[model samples]
Target: MKTLILFVALVGYTQALSYSDVLEEEWNRFQLDYTKFYQTEDEALLRRLIFVDNKRRIDKHNRRFMAGKESYEMGVNQFTDLLPKEFQSQMLSSLNITEAEGLIDFRYTAPRDVDPPSSIDWRARGAVTPVMDQGENCGSCWAFATTGTLEGQTFLKTGRLVSLSEQNLIDCSNDAPYYNEGCKGGLELNALMYIMHKGIDTESSYPYRGTQQKCRFNSSNIGASVEAFIGVSGEANLAAATAFHGPVSVRVDSEGMQSYKGGVYNNPNCSDEILDHAMVVVGYGNDKSGGDYWLVKNSWGTTWGENGYIRMSRNRNNQCGIATIAVFPIV
Candidate 1:
């Protein structure tokens, strides 16, 4: 019986070592996948701790998803090493409504009363440009959102789908009045105003650096110019405007979207009042299984969500404030 007990203890020790080895392999794989670098070993250890915790939560969430308890799934991504607060500080920023002193209201430029289709995708219509990555630790989602909306509108007006410059807005719009602070944070309406005053250039002409620098906007290389922009209100109005005009820029609470993988996102923890991130509403549709959803375009790269997009719960009391401060450029 002593030999039997010794054999059981050996098996337990072997299993424990195997678990540790697997965890170390996962950490190594994560670092390699995201190209993670640290200034010191201590910092790397701290980040590993955070990443492991995030991985645990992701596994738990995905388990719930597989069990049909969750509407969406969570997975390890580039954001796995950062805490929620760290991720928010590095990636998210809310729009300041108090700064909007002079901008067109939705009531004035609202689309004519028309029966919007049950579903509409601007991508299928050859209006939206390809999804873009905002890069690491940059809160330039507003710039991407602005460019996306303009690209769609430009396509509709000029019959050309041109990728506009986010770097142009990131650099130039940071000055007084516009207040678009590059990677720090910015407002979408402020960005629109900047585009109206100084026409933006093409993405190829002014590539994205994901950093704040001196304004180098060349008016001669302007890609698309807009006469004015309007701030839309309500989900119905937002849907109509997107269907009629094209993609619309909007803000939302992206607090729990860090590890989001796919499916109709319906986070009960997400607040509708706290709009923290800017994205474009590319389209909307009713999922046969997941119910109604707003197809949103995120700038977190193609590896983040559904090919750099998220299907947010829509028409459910303005889930995540998607329709709170929507705006679109008029070409």
Candidate 2:
């Protein structure tokens, strides 16, 4: 009896070791896939631990999805290693728009009175450029969002889809009246106003460095210039504006998107009062099973969500502030 008990204990110890080995292998593979390089061994170990914990949560969430208890699925991506707070501070911008700022006066023009189509996709209309990756530790989503709206407007006007420079806004747009603080954080309205004043440069002329630097904006290489901007509110108005205009810049609470993989995303934690990340509304449609969803383009890269896009819950009382602050530039 004593021998049998000892053998059982040994088997349990071996099983624990096997589980540890598998987790280590997974950590190694994740690092290799993402090209993650840690500056110190201690940092790498801490990241590995965080990765394991995140993986566990992701697996549990997926299980719930499989059981039809959840609408969306969560999976591992580049953000699996970072803690939630760390991810928010690094990726999301600190949006501090006062109530007065929210009030759009003469600038906010309603779209032409016409019923919008059942669905609309700006990408299919030869407007949207390819998805872009905003590198880690940078809160410059506002720049990307602003550029996307301008890129669409430019295409519609010039019959050419030219990618504009987010780096230009990041480096040059931080000043009075339009204070876009480069990677630290910024606002789409401010970036758009800066472009309206000083025409933007092309992405090829001024490439993205993922960091703020000395302004290298050249007026000679102007890619697109914004004449003015129009703001709209409410689900019906946002849809109408997107259908008539090109992609619209909007803000949302992006905390729920850290590990988002696929499916129509909806989280109770998402609120319009805490809009932290900016993105572009490329299209909107209804998922029969998932209900209505707004197809949004994120700047986190092609590997992040549905090829750098997310289908956010739409027409559900303005989930994630999709209609709270929507604006589009007129090129």
Candidate 2: segments with Cα more than 4 A from true spot: 1-22, 99-103, 107-113
- Model 1: pairs clashing at backbone N, Cα or C within 3 Å: none
Model 2 C-alpha lDDT per residue in residues 1-331, reported as the tens digit of each score: 9999999999997877865687788888999999999999999989999999998888889999999887788888999999999998888886765732663443444456668888999999999999999899889999999999889988988899999999999999998888778998998888888888899999999999999999999999899997778886788888888887879889888876899998899886688868899999999998877788898999999999899999999888888787888888877
Global Cα RMSD, each model: 4.0, 4.7
Task: Please estimate how well model 2 matches the true structure, expressed as its whole-model Cα lDDT.
Answer: 0.87
Show where candidate 1 strays beyond 4 Å. Answer: 1-21, 106-113
> Cα lDDT for residue 83, model 1?
91
* Model 2 TM-score (2 dp): 0.91
Question: What are the per-residue Cα lDDT tens digits for candidate 1 across 1-331?
Answer: 9999999999997877864576688899999998999999999999999988888888889888898888888887889999999999888887665554245554524456567899999999999888888887889999999999999999999899889999999889987778777899988788888888889999999999988877888989899988888788789888888888889998999988999999999986777778889999999999876789999999999989999999999888988888877888888
**lDDT of each model, Cα atoms only?**
0.87, 0.87
